[model samples]
Target: MADKAAAQEFDILILGGGSGGYAAALRSVELGFSVGLIEKGKLGGTCLHNGCIPTKALLHSAEIAENAKTASKYGINATFDSIDMTAVNSYKDNIIAGKFRGLQGLIKSKGITVIEGEGKLTSEKTIEVNGETYTGKNIILATGSYSRSLPGLEIGGKVITSDQALKMDTVPKSAVILGGGVIGVEFASVWNSFGVDVTIVEGLPSLVPNEDAAIIKQLERAYKKRGIKFSTGIFFDNVQQNDDGVVVTLADGKKFEADLLLVAVGRGPVTANLGYEEAGLTMDRGFVITNERLHTGVGNVYAVGDIVPGLQLAHRGFQQGIFVAEEIAGLKPVVVDDANIPKVTYCEPEIASVGLTEAKAKDKLGAENVEIQEYNLAGNGKTSILGSSGLIKMVREKDGPIVGVHMIGARIGEQIGEAQLIVNWEAYPEDIASLIHAHPTQNEALGEAAMALAGKPLHG
Candidate 1:
């Protein structure tokens, strides 16, 4: 245990050194404020150490395996012999290590005090760690989240969460993943590419249910083509694990047995026992309730990241962190609407969208006022060359600005930056249609969609 000091003070104190916390620290330091970043584990927290970096690394490895497996289609003489789990794990670990080192270097260079320990809020403006008190003029809560499981489902033996899945030494012969959200589908994609018999059980009507219905349809088709099995709109009734393996029973009495069961229901805020309620922070179902500006209704206190409850994305956390820092610095940053935040699921044939879904757009803007145009990747030169098929759908008001951009295709996540800007800035289709996109690129698909939406069809 470290010594109990009188107290250390800072201009800003951020809890949980994940994407959100770290981003806030960096921005606060740049604003010439003393920052204290506290974390129990690694500096990069879950996203870099366990969540985003590692998972994306696995997804990339899966993509490589898929590419090699289908190299014959590209007229290449190549064979994907087998996935070396050890080598794959090594590759993933290396990427995480490199990023972790870079993050630490950045924090050190910014002169932010990196406090190493678990911190609990002792008051609205103070945190206590290792029996030492630290006070800040302003305190930002960015505790992040953890994987959650269903009731009566014990996580042990062969049943695991993503945190355990990332550390597995051997790939299972078969897996039954519960919950077909972003995490479930991603792991299903990876395991399928690695030669595992994977099945996804989602209680929703479709996989990636939060996405646009059209995008979900395309993703289902792609997954079906890949022979990845999934059961949707059905809840599992029971799960039993024996020494040999695990068996999951659906509500319809259908049974699925696999070497392991992955519970990917979603993540819950890590707000329990953190003294949030004691500090008078308003919370709903464990998530800190904040105003549009992210205020916690307490003096000099604010919350960001997964704990704030909009999108659980690390990038969302990053943006919220910066927003909170700027707000504290009296920058009066414009509040970013959650709907406008870009979301990318890094599954095979990735899904990326910004702003409203078509249904959402119609509901909000009225069906009579909404217009949509979907451009198929089958018509795009680059997608055909890459042996991929997808669609870029644009939703806009009948004669107004584009409200949403939905896409499904290989490497489509890379196009989210422009889509986010377009939606957030309320750019009209004509405004984007006039801009030239590079020839023979997947991104040009967006331009094509915009052109068609703006009353001119180009290679549609």
Candidate 2:
């Protein structure tokens, strides 16, 4: 107690109680360091509130409605004539609130002090929050990100960001999404199932430009079959809201009209006006420059998560937070492998991938050394039973190991858990193919792909 009072603060003071911040706080405390966490809003951050959790809840509702319509083929007759947005919003809010409460409990159990308000980094080892000055030996900047809007398209009323999309009281009759990235596509899947006419305008040549070219083609077909429209290789020029709806103009001089306009171009780090400039930390292209050890140019200071760029994900935040905490405790934790981090986009036919894509693999290992083996879900008994179809592509090096894995299918996001293990472990095709997979499961697609890469396939 004397030592604690003599300190007058904490060993570690972290800003932003997002996924990364909370993880840092908890891990720091567990490692025997007195920790302090400051957050302006909810504990779980954007992913739990506006981003991952709420969007997924809404997507699940869309999926339930879709499944009900197709229930007759499975020997059951069910119909969904109208969607209840009120009920959906209620369900979404309840789940989000419950999760937030759970986060608060977990933080409390770890003995980490959490403060409610924005935290401004005052110096290398101090933060100011809620009219109180907190001193610490180490400070971490984990302030995450917010949805980015176009230059000409302001977000409000009929034109909104994903935050507004999550709590919409009434379902729009039609939606025109700007930017065919993960957010746009996921919303497309959501509103389309809600009987809204959805159109995606992408500045890139293909939807999910970061994905494999083949997977993008498969998604294009699937979305088209579901009555979603795509306007790829076009940019949004303007967004104007009238009494009736919103009208959007494209770079190609085309016009699109919808009840709502969603600017899902991307997100930017929330480092603006948070005293980062006053501290004089290094920043590169709107992202804080941090070393592999998660330290900034300023001593006793570090930055993590979206603020540091490269794979803005909640799990990555957790890992970085843990790493920084362990490092500060003098435990010398193993450096995090960013490549091992998995990414998932929840839509009708979800997209999930870990490690490299075929293009990325070929660039690294040379075309001759790389090989891509694919298994179509149409050939999988489990997928057929589920009335879903897609493909799984595995990237391997010439008799080496699986370097990348990409998947597209209904509920395929769930399968990424195993796919990531194989990629991260650098397991050879023969290594996985030698093992027996349970019969009639979507996971069999992975097994079959491994077999094909091993020069023998059960189903191709």
Candidate 3:
């Protein structure tokens, strides 16, 4: 397809081509809307070009190295050695570029117009890109987010954000990670596997603070066994860069030095310079506020993804994007239940959760009504065979229904599909317990946990 000149019109004009933007564009086009997607950056947005894709590529390299070293225990004798950062980075880049190309092709196949430039919402129905105005019946914002930093700390050579850390050409000898959320734990696992001295400083009481307490404890023990250190319930006092590296000062009057400092606190929405406020939209902090229907304050304007509040996962953006597209197509789509959405942290011994945590369940359903059961991975044959460590936790009301399930273990994120089904359907423990799980598979852990909650457990 050849590039078209300035003048054009679209049925739906989308600003920001990240996960949410692309999702909305494709869905809108499928709904018979002439779509135009305005992207200032790459087609795949931060996820494909930076955040999720590249980080996973780097983490996979760590997983491979660690697996090779432990191959003998899995019935194969193999010796793992050094890591070539050059080769690793090349591999990561190639993967990212390939996926981006695939995404571009998909967008083109959908017959959606792609405008390469910064997009500004001139109004609810008008968007300006590359100095050209494109009018549409409806508008969607899906700019996503960027890594954030604390007050005193800033990004430099030695001090960096996830964006910079993902592209490092050389591995640091030692590193200090300032957060213990999903990003921090994932990076800590990656660096620790690469033979770096890793220390995680978390303001919360435990790592993966949003997860179940049992899961957090399991992860803490596993990370500690792998030589990763943690300083929880503490704060960062100051960080000063020197010739060797950066000196991280804690609020407790202790100092730690590292070759690199990764600030993995969180991400801030990418709504600035997008003309959201000028378009008469309501925003909190940097996030765009939207109703359950994903409608913005501006008439005929909507927002999704990191720009909209709640979970910042890409899949969540995809759902919201599709929902708004269908809603605009006059399908009268059902509202999304935020609590039904599943969340996963892609670290080794990955954490996956859906619905309420134990504390939240108690608060919502009352302590006497809520019940929880846990199945240790140690009792599962599959986990024992793979030498994986973690547990499966289930929360339900007394004879009511299963409301939540949380898991932690190697490749356990994959199991959330089953957990989500049970939770979303509000299935009772008896319902899941009646079904048979394949023997010696990781999914059997879910069945076991459910069975235990049903008052009888075959394993653990």
Candidate 4:
């Protein structure tokens, strides 16, 4: 009910210009709607600025360092020098800067108004920023997330989170990672390749517990071989930091001391103090609760990205943003199942999976109603040539369609495109088997698994 005379109005108003917000703006504009995007930080938000882009750049640098360390094994004479942190960080910054510039250009080219300031929801369809009101017919909430910590475990000094880890000028000599989720495992891989002694403590029984059990086994084996130590099924009791380092004591009285301790537990939704409750939007445990269609139960309001729960991924945010825009445009976008969303952990041996796990499939269907086929990468000519080992496991309803595909190997994350298509499209094993994968490629392993599931094993 504030005066509308001085307020800016648009067809769509987006909050938090992250993956979801920016994507919603772009898509809405493309659909011939006037859009206004408000952001507190850089346009890219956490994914581009802190979380995804920067971390992936570090992971790629880690891969280069690892490859150099093993260059002699490939019959190439090259000295593996110590990692130059300055140079490595420069590379990461360069990539981020370029992407940031491009995003700014795209926003400008799309003719969307970009407002720079913190925005608070004043009503169901209005956001107040810097003493100015922005109103839209439809509003999309895409406030992202932040790194989370435990009750007593604080992040300061040597006890850090991924955000701090990303900004560190020098890699620690030794580090203890608090969680074994995607973020934890990724940092562990990077630090290990940088010659740090890394130990991961996971509360679950296995690292990357969300992945298929077989994939977890392979990852553990690979981590062990890389000398990356991990303690699973143990909970940390407390953490103490001193002049020397940080010590993490487990519930069972075991202690681990390292130069730094990284708390990679998970990310929590940043829905606090944003006036969501004031706007009558329901929230649970800090996450905004949205319906299958992403409605916020409020008039003309929708939520997307990490705040909306389900998969806390940037790409998922992108999809949801686009979907919400299309829905607002009366396009009636198809609802995507969260289970069909592809997940990839960029650790040493990357773990990528789409659709249900074997256990989940068996639980959903009867154990006898599902069939699983695992094709070892050892049989794949490309993997063997690269001296890497992994497996591609496909899960399907008995004599029905392929419901899941899980993979673990070097550069295997690239194959999730085909895997997700197969699962999301509900393609039968025989359907994929009829297709051809090029010779001596890592992708051939997926095709091999499909063929084996189709009852014709080319190279079992």
Give a tens-digit lDDT track for model 4, residues 1-460. 4445434898999999999999999999999999999999999999998999999999999998988988999998887789899999899999999999999999999999998999999999799999988898999999999999999787788899989898888979999999999999999999999999999999889999898999999999999999999999988899888899988899999999999999999999999999999999999999999899998989999999999878999999999999999999998999856989999999879999999899999999989999999998988899888888899999999989999999999889999999999999999999999999999899988888999999999865
Query: What is candidate 2's local distance difference test score?
Result: 0.88
lDDT of 3 by residue, 1-460 (tens): 1234334677788888988899999999888999989999898788888788888898899999999989988888888888899999999999988898899999999899898999888998998887888877888888889999998677897899998898788888999999999999999999988999999999888998988888898999999899999999988888999999999999998888999899999998988888889988998998898888999968899998988888888888888889989999999998877888998888887899998888889999999999999998988888888788789999998889999999999889889999999999999999999998998899988988999999997754
Q: What is the lDDT of residue 285 in candidate 3?
A: 94
Query: How much lDDT does each candidate structure score?
Result: 0.92, 0.88, 0.89, 0.93
Selected candidate, larger lDDT, 3 vs 4: 4
| Candidate 1 local lDDT, 1-460, one digit each (tens) | 2333323788999999999999999999999999999999998778998899999999999999989999999899999999888999999999999998999999999999999999999998899999888989999999999999999998999999999999887989999999899999999999999999999999888999999999999999999999999999989898998887999999999999999999999999999999999999998999999999999999999999999978898988899999999999999998957888899999989999999899999999899999999998999898888788998999998899999999999899999989999999999999999999999889888888999999999875
Compute each candidate's TM-score over C-alphas.
0.98, 0.97, 0.97, 0.98
lDDT of 4 at 264: 95
Q: How accurate is candidate 3 locally (lDDT)?
A: 0.89
Better of 2 and 3 by lDDT: 3
Candidate 2: stretches off by over 4 Å = 1-8
Q: Which pairs clash (backbone N, Cα, C closer than 3 Å) in model 2?
A: none
Q: Clashes in candidate 3: how many?
A: 0
